[model samples]
Target: MLKKLFLVAAAAALFSGCANVMPTGGGSASDAADVAAAAERLRIAMVDPTRPALSTLVADELSYGHSGGKVDTKESFIADLLDGKSDFVTITITEQTVKVVDARTAIVRHALAADTNDSGKPGKVALKILGVWQKQGGDWKLLARQAVRAS
Candidate 1:
């Protein structure tokens, strides 16, 4: 009887330890909120762009896709913003949703409406954007983004 009791106690302790471990899928509420905040920061940075701010928000291997099928790397994306090649006069994001795929990754979707002055030509755009965010060292960074023209 004593041996059985020891085994039961050992099993209970092991199982309790497992309880503290996060699941491989699904994240906590705070994780979702943090991702949303990171996306908002990126939106703000895009409208009023600064090299340092944009560099911090995007990953080194960022792949940014435009509604017109053009893609930009991390360097090009920042350069265009700073150089007025791709300019955003004002931006508004709506119908935003964030899905935490895991503890370290999230998928965010939103509608982007903006007035732009790209290459000194004024224009407006409405797009549906999908962004992939990855947490690195506690801060979420945009790894990839794709945009399509809104119908």
Candidate 2:
């Protein structure tokens, strides 16, 4: 019985090779476009400061950092955006690049120019932004983001 079990295990291992089990994690053109669309939706949502949109796009474990050396959790980020503390008048992203890392991960980089009315004060910024988007429950959500002042 032991001999038979060993043989069966070996056969199973041989049949279930690494090639059959390893992750094939390349995104198709359509997938890339879809991710881009999600990102666009997120951008529009931020400028609009829509709560549901922000909540939907952002993961619960999000780590959001600003060019001013302040970092915020997902809750705080969304709260500030909704509270008019981070009011955005216009947000324009340029030189955007999206790289799909694996089946569940993607990296996006862009030059962001945002005109804002922060706490009733006008502000404008140019930043080079990097973000990580992860697929969860079949939807891509922002996991982390960092921004640096653009030179």
Model 2 has an lDDT value of 0.76
Query: Which stretch of 10 consecutive residues in model 2 shows the poorest summed lDDT?
Result: 15-24
List residue ranges in candidate 2 displaced over 4 A.
Answer: 1-25
Predicted model with the maximum TM-score: 1
Put down candidate 1 lDDT per residue, 1-151, tens digits, no spaces: 6985575456434433322222236776677767776776677678778898898899999999988889999999999999999899998777777778898998888888999999999999999999999999988899999999999
TM-score per candidate: 0.82, 0.81
lDDT of 1: 0.81
Question: On residues 80-124, what C-alpha lDDT tens digit does candidate 2 reach at each position?
Answer: 889989888998877777777677787878888999998899989
CA-lDDT, candidates in order: 0.81, 0.76
